[model samples]
Target chain A: MTLNTWIDLVYLLAAIGFILALKGLSSPKHARNGNLLGAAAAAVAIGFTFAYPEVRAHTLNLVLTLVAMAIGAAIAVPAARMVKMTAMPQMVAIFNGVGGGAAALISIVVFLLEAPGKPAVYRIAEVLFGVLVGSVSFSGSAIAFAKLQELMTGRPITYPAQQAINAVVGVTIVALAVGTLVTGNVPLLVATAVLSLVLGVIFVLPIGGADVPVLISLLNSFTGLAVAASGFTLNNNLLIIAGTLVGASGILLTRMMSKAMGRSLANVLFSAFGSVVTAAGGADGSAESRPVKAGTPEDIGVLLAYARKVVIIPGYGLAVAQAQHTARELADLLMERGVEVFYAIHPVAGRMPGHMNVLLAEANVPYDELKEMDEANPEMSTADVALVIGANDTVNPAAKNTPGSPIYGMPIINADDAENIVFLKRSMRPGFAGIDNELLFDEKTTLLFGDAKDTLAKLVAAVKDA
Target chain B: MSTGILEFLTIFVLAALVGNEVIGRVPSILHTPLMSGSNAIHGIVLVGAILVMGSASGAMQVTLAFLAVLLATLNIVGGFVVTDRMLEMFKPKPVERAPKASDASGDDATGSPK
Candidate 1:
């Protein structure tokens, strides 16, 4: 067989490796190995591309490629390695953004190369699609990263005519894209690119922090589709397969994320839902003055020590205070006292879907001990104490009982079903949804005000004494 | 459309179907890891960047290709390494049978008081 044939076969093998890697990632037992396999597949593909006749002939380009890769690795390794677990969402955002940026650059360069000869109309269409979607994903992910990293406001930013403005921008981009297609004009393409970037930022600006995960998933899918468009431009099968896979999966994942919150994808995207906080806050101004029963750590610790069953519901505050370890310690102490202990995880808990699981896993909490919302809700009524640590919106009765509330119709943990409710919180501030949680003021609820980690430590000591 | 484009389109459609089927089964607990893993996979765009760079002419083309390679490299390298790190914590530790047994006994002792 010729060298070209052999190279194609190798690429095919690498493609199969990527498929298996994705399969392995979905399951708990094989996730790590699956990720490693994917890395190997990527390395093999990149290594073989070096042997392509054209690539090999260009010694200077090859040298530049190697140096660029080395520099990318230098920046990527340390950043990925040293990032705090709480910052994981934004880390993924930045990485995904860079990928989208890369896809746009590839499309633009290819368009420039083919422009001299006036490439086929279909090919130009592909290039334009890549430029549009890729640029949007790039800038959108950047905004997502900023919000999650606290570099900007995590709350949804809304203005009058927001939807109308976005629509105008969208229509202009389409017009510019058509202009590029008809004339094959580089400047028109550039204009399309810039407008698409602007659309991405405006598109993401009104999505609050709680909804950023779903937004990120959608952007991830956008990046995938952008890559697929580039694949069509380059006529690369491996890129086509990999990009299509990600695109399809990302869309499904985005749907799943929205479904988990009991909301539609469009509602999540366009509602500027959390912006109702200000209106809700103004209406419920007296909420802060409402009486809430306060308990000393010692008393609550004794209550926990003697309880037959205890359910822990952890939230973003738990992550923000770096309290997972302390929470685990508290669970262990309670378990030693013969209390049944398990963590009730909300689907949208801790800023992202499944985020609480990652944090708790990092703390060595057994997977079996971490229960999803549906599994934990039925058991809530039987629990003696529902210990809410640094969580608010997920367990809020407002999501269910108050139809007018910002977070209405969303599913929440039935924390009120427990015989007693003990909350560990820093203050009376509302959660990410920016709505009041009436559950906090329920008759059976007891508030223990303090930092999560410090309060968890205090609860552990109090339990030990009991 | 040419037969070549048609074939590529067929492949793309089939791949999308396969992706939806496989990814549909992943439980919510692994959603974060799944997203990150797929993020790494799309880094396959690096191949396109490399191929274009190989035949690039003039300073502008080279400059754009270089940036593409750099960004794609970051996507692949950072994406995979970070995913591995996230999944590393997911590796199940040997369930401490000893603790469970002791926990059972401790339950008995504490159960009488309640």
Candidate 2:
């Protein structure tokens, strides 16, 4: 057999590794090993790419490739290692964006190479597809990163004729893509590329911060499709398989994320869902005017220690205060006093799906102690106290009771079912949804205002004394 | 379409189905990790970048190919490293402490019952 055949076989093996890696990642027991296996597969594939006859013949190109790779690794390793767990969503966005950008560049370069000779019409179509989807994914992920990193406002940015403008741009891009396909005009493709980039930015801009996770997932799928288009242009089976895999899975994930929030993909994308602050729940006046029962940490702690069952609902605010460890300590203390305690995790609790799980796992919280929304909701009625740590919307009764509320019809944790509700919050500020939580003003709910970490620390001490 | 494209299309369709089937079962607890892991997998675009760069002749082609390689490299390295870091937290801890006995252990034992 020739060297080419042998290399193709190795590439096939690497592809299988990627499949197994995805399989392993889905299960908790094998997730870490699964990721390691994928890394190994990637390394093998890259190592073999260097052995290709064409690549080996170009010594200078090979040298340049190695140098560029070294520079990329230099930036990636430390950034990956040093990023705070809370910043993980944006980090993923940035990395995905760069990959999309790379795919777009590859397509553009191939198109440029073939333009001189009038490339095949089919090849031109593939190049245009890659340029459009890849550029969109690249810029869309950038905006997502900016939103998550708080470099810009997380709320949806909308103006008059916003949807109309986006529509016009979309049609223009399609027209340009057709122009490029018919005549193979370089300028037409460039215009398509530029407009696609603009389309990505505007596409993501109107999605509220809370919905960015779904947007990111959709953009991730777009990047995958773009890569697959590039694969078609290059006639590389490995790229086609890998890219299609991500594309399909990412779409499913995007749907799943939206479902978790009780919304459709289109609604999440176009509704600009949280842009308008609704005056529901009599929140028209300043928040300070509303009276809420504020309880001292010591008092709340005594109540928690004596309860037969306790449920802790954590949110983005808890993550912001870096209070996962303290929350775990409080749970441990409660369990010591014979209180049955478990964390109730909403699917979209943190910035990304399962984000809270990562934070709690870092704090050494046992997996069994973390109950999903479905499992925990049924137990809410039996619990004596619902300890809400830095969470708001997920536990808001407004979702069920307020029909006109933006978050209406969404499923929420039944925190109201518990006998007593103890909320640890910094202030009366609303959650990411920017709507008043009527539950906070309920009779059974008592607020403890402070930074989550400080309040949790105080609670731990108070629970111990009790 | 040529037989070559047809064959690729077949593979693409099958792979996408397989991906959807496999990923559908991933519980929500691992969604973030799954997203990032798949993000790393698609970084296979680096292979395409390398091939194009190898054949690049002019300065313009070389410059674009170099940027592609660089960006693709960043995607691969950063994607895998970040995913591994996130999954690392999910790794089952070694028995840090004895399991809590039904009686006097006071639930202070850090070891999970599992």
Candidate 3:
């Protein structure tokens, strides 16, 4: 049939690949294949897009596009191969930001091209909406990525009149958007674009680190919605379909992460973690003197040896070490030594939800022995030894005492309740959100500094010796 | 070479930024519970696809939207179902080995737990 019709068919197939790839990504086993399928579909769509007479005719822009593509591909490959697992959430945020920026850019380009002479109120409104959503997603996501990756403080930075300032910016964006629409002026449109971008950064500036996972999920959804809106503006079937898919999923994920943290979504976004300031626990003097004691693999193994009741309080540290398998082996050895061994897994442990448990299961730890905080909290009181792995915030007692702390209302592991707490840490550095861990200060706690893998291996040997 | 390159870049960059290896390094210690949690996010992808497709106004858009919705739905629902079933299977079965005063195997001192 016609080339146009053939291109449409190709796009439709690409959309299917998006669907399958997303679905396949649900399970780790199929994620690889699903991703490949989605990639192939995307490739076909791109090739077909070039076949369109209008797109092909722009040769200079076309070459630039190819060059840009090459640069992007080159960067992505090595980074994917080299980046650490801890950085995934941040990476996701950054990626979402780029998609949003692209969508916003696309919408603007289309509006300018199609309405070179003039446009109606509705077109202006749609264009403005596109710019606002896209800019917000892009800027907000970049900040979020920064927060998660520790490039910036995870805590909120606010002033007495920050909300008012945010409101002023918000109003400015809307006014500019509406003005650009009614006036049909290019410069005004440009102004609105800048305003929208600034507004996004300001919007997320006051957000604390604890809420980032939710934000990631939410931003992911934003990127999708932005794409869909752009698709609508351009009347593209695939963009609309794919964008909606991403947006809807992101919203759902935000809700789930909110629930996992035992907080509502609104509480996470609008409210500043203003309460963490008044908490009893602080990074203050008492916490400072209580040095974060570090030990070697040899020291921890020695403690595990012949201990009556050894408890493993794994946090994000355990997740990061990818040491669950080794930890499990250590436990098995302890168990063989006539030492009671159990895992105290906190509810909100690791970078994302269920991070610790996922890591442990990879090592094949028995599900039954893994204790929830409510159940495990009490166990820490009497255990001979408490192995505090890469976890920080969840185990912190500050969560309970400091209402001013960002994570004040969140529940934590009472690892401080244990007989002796051994912290398996990499360094004295603070956690993802940069909050000081007060649990490290307890007289009962001792720091064992090393990678989770190395420490667990040492423990395995020590337990064997006993 | 040109158009799809942007989209591909999006996916790979997304993977890298999110600690591509994090999920891959799922420690056995956290498996069942972690799966249960991430499963919920996966479900979101389904909802997203549905909403996108549902709002569309044409045959091709509709078809594409439908494909996304169906797949997302299956991904989430199937994941949760598998997790529940696995949880059930993993539920500490009645132990044939008689209990001793100190079953140091980290066995439930509190008895079979949910």
Residue B3 accuracy (lDDT) in model 3: 47
* Top model number, lDDT: 1
CAPRI-style quality class for the chain A–B interface of candidate 2: medium
**How would you encode candidate 2's per-residue C-alpha lDDT over A319-393 as one tens digit per residue?**
999888788778877776778999999998988999999988877788889999999999999999999999998
Off by over 4 Å in 2: A273-285, B93-114
Per-residue C-alpha lDDT of model 1 across residues A12-103, encoded as one tens digit per residue: 89888888988899898999999999999989988888878987678888888788889988999999999987888899999999999999
Sorting all predicted structures by DockQ, with the top scorer first, yields 2, 1, 3
Better of 1 and 3 by lDDT: 1
Find the 10 residues in a row with the least total lDDT in model 1 chain A. Answer: A273-282
**Per-candidate RMSD, Å:** 3.9, 3.1, 10.7
Pitting candidate 1 against candidate 3, the one with the higher TM-score is 1
The TM-score of candidate 1 is 0.94
Q: Against the hidden true structure, what lDDT does model 2 obtain?
A: 0.87
Candidate with best DockQ? 2
lDDT of 3 by residue, A133-239 (tens): 87788889889888877788777766667777888988887787777877888778879888888888887877777677677667666766666666556555666
